[model samples]
Target: MTDEAFKREVKTLYVAEAEDGIRLDRWFRRRWPHLSNIQVQKMARSGQIRVDGARIKPEGRLTAGAAVRVPPIPDAVVRAPGEHQALSPADVAFAKSLVIYEDDLVIALNKPWGLAVQGGTKTTRHVDRLLSAWGEGMERPRLVHRLDRDTSGVLLLGKGPEAAKRLAGAFARRQAKKTYWALVIGLPKPTAGQIDLPLKKTGINDFEIMRPADAKEHGAEPAETAYALISHAGQRASWLALRPFTGRTHQLRAHMKAIGHPILGDTKYGDAVSAELSGPLKLQLHARRIELDHPSGGKLIVEAPLSPEMRAGFQHFGFEEAEADADPFAGVRRMR
Candidate 1:
């Protein structure tokens, strides 16, 4: 073939099981490490790269079985095979140790508190970067959902493109159920009830916070949470179980605050009195359980135990951790 023809040749690739649910730019990066972000964005914007014959955004997600048309680039632009950065042994081991459950399609990690799920401004270390260490000889895992940096919980990763698509869909469609445990400064007046509050974000960038709003408020979205008192320490504080029906940023924390019992140690939502009573001041929320339909079939349930800080607080309040094992929403009617 002529040099000009070779340089203009187009190639088509099928999204493999492992590459599912990855961002379009990331997919290209994995295949062409030398492709700069600007090149990828330009390609996406100019329609040089198409997925299933449709122009897509760089942030668009890929699913298994999709066909991607990749325009040819000069060989000089490709990186040498060995030029990619290597994963450190320590990062790999730490990533592997967080795996509480793993299968062919997915992996669940008991993510510890203070661990960011994805990178951000001023945030260098995160689970998404560590996932690279686990991707050796396999497809890099993709995050389906996220937990707060200060919240410890069962975080799920899709092993491949197909699993990632299914898992992400489950969360988007509310097919997944999550249970959280928190130590609140004061007991909720009703003990067990639903908080059907609309929420709107306030502030800019990293300073953003979700607050209760009227239904007609601009950018307001409906959010509901079911909370039940599991135990209390003489009305001064209480251990509560929370189930969020709507996935809003900071739904649990904001809802708890709306009900006049912000979670203990939640400095963002709690008042000075609440913070003083929260003991060590570590955020007391823990994502204790998650249930969802498995990508392969049937049901999947994963649980994460409380962090040492929360566990100590639970013990001090005379709350039994085993009590959380029972259904927190058993008697309460679900309000969608």
Candidate 2:
């Protein structure tokens, strides 16, 4: 990739403007005033700038409005031999836009509504795979936890082995805290209460593995939870802040279904009460906040704002004027 040592510049260059033939780097200098020639020089040294799929010297002159392709600037990624197979720089850039917070060890992203974390037999191009390509040279960051493909926001990834193990332990021991912002049909009657339901994942049903609340008296792991009413009354749907003390597979989804209110877009869990479901939303679940101990020392608290879609839905329900980061449960901590 460093073929442009001497000619450190671009090859297949195109500029759409009507400027005269100016030195390539000089033209770039004027265009991107923030970048210095030295920075441009470094880019040329990397053989990243191409004229027409060819590397050119930095001094090469450019025709006006010519298309110039600059090799993407590398972030703090660990480059590998060929670990980047199907992914492109554009894909990586898009994924980075989803990030809400990041440190050396982890990244918090706003996952869109319809993507999976890990692929099944037929599923491909998951967020996990995309992120795997990001930490390329590094240990290829893996999901420390998972959010339903349809759920959005505050998703976390462990940058390396130590961080990964520490994060996993935090979750297992309930040291990590996850708070979800959800839109459910009808207000929870009590307004605020805990649902200490036991959740299990058995082949229980082909439709879904979630155990029903009526039959929830079987042998299963005890699931503790706390929730508060964000706002409820006239709106057919109510906004809730959900905190699941234990991370169980589909724990929130199943538990919500077990109670009277299933999430808006949960077809699997809402089948029986599907009639209660209304509105254009499919799954109104958002991973609003995640707090965990950083691998290095200090604590980390990452919060994701509501997605555009969810925000619009909230506006439709006349609750668009909600509080931002209104954590009534703020300052709460768990001992590891």
Candidate 3:
């Protein structure tokens, strides 16, 4: 009868004429913006979401009158639109503390490590929830881009729908330049070069990870990263500047590992040296900077200071922060 009731039980409904020929994933997104593309695909794969009593691909088109089956959605994913989660005074202060830059068009945050950009299964505490303290409805800020839970960096948010659309366009058009700094377990052989590799998602159950894939591999997508060796503390570890030309899940981590130099503190893809070098430090990856066309005018360049752990790693590795170029992507061309 109601949306909440639907979340508690499976429902089969016929698609209306207005929704005919729409992609299954898009249909879900129009109804539930909280369900990520990956989440919807996972549901379809597990048969939690079905069409005509059979599992269908996320991209599959739906015909009018088709019976679409939607299983019970998690309460986290079924919140009404524009509803802000109630926040305590402490939560409001915590959200404000992360803000580094803000304007009429956008808000830039120095997202700390171990904080998720959005909510998901078992992810109750995250930036999205924190943002609830800012505002609600059309005036509320919206996420423009995302950073990994363990990666600290410059994260951007839009002031409203129009601003969000413009900011998102920069990323979709590949016009946004992102730079990262990482302490890798071992030195890359070439010292500096572009990693031109394809990657595909692979994992077990709820856990998913990206792995290097052949160009011809099914579902594989092209991924590229240009890196320069800033310095190294012997063969045990190296500090490097990384620029990714394409965005993919775990692109930087997978690229570094593919080259036999996994990032330090990366438990998923790291080597023995990574574990040894990490010790008490977190994943040695930081989104150092981002440059893109601002929603209102000229280029906007923002840089996030290193996390405390990253600074410690620099000291331990005998790497000078001053050695990192302010504009690491200068004169770099996008790899084909």
> Local distance difference test, per candidate?
0.79, 0.65, 0.79
> How well is each residue in 50-124 modelled by candidate 3, as lDDT tens digits?
887788999998764456778765554455543434677998899999988899998989988899876554566
lDDT of 2 by residue, 230-286 (tens): 876464678888888766667788887777887776766765454355446667788
**What residue runs in model 3 are displaced by over 4 Å at the alpha carbon?**
1-85, 204-206
Cα deviation of 109, candidate 2, in Å: 1.2
Better of 2 and 3 by TM-score: 3
Tell me the spans in candidate 1 whose CA falls farther than 4 Å from its real position: 1-44, 48-85, 136-138, 331-334
How close is every model to the real structure, measured as TM-score?
A: 0.78, 0.68, 0.78
TM-score, candidate 2, is 0.68
Tens-digit lDDT string for candidate 1 (1-336): 443553476755455433446689987875555678898999999999999799999999987546688898544354444322455798789989999999999999999989987654445578877887664323678677778889998898888657876787777666678889999987778898899999888986467798999999986878888988888999799999998877777889999998889988887888988978986858999988888999999999999877887887887788887666456876555575
- List per-candidate RMSD values in Å: 7.0, 18.2, 8.2
Give the range where candidate 2 is weakest over 10 consecutive residues by summed lDDT.
10-19
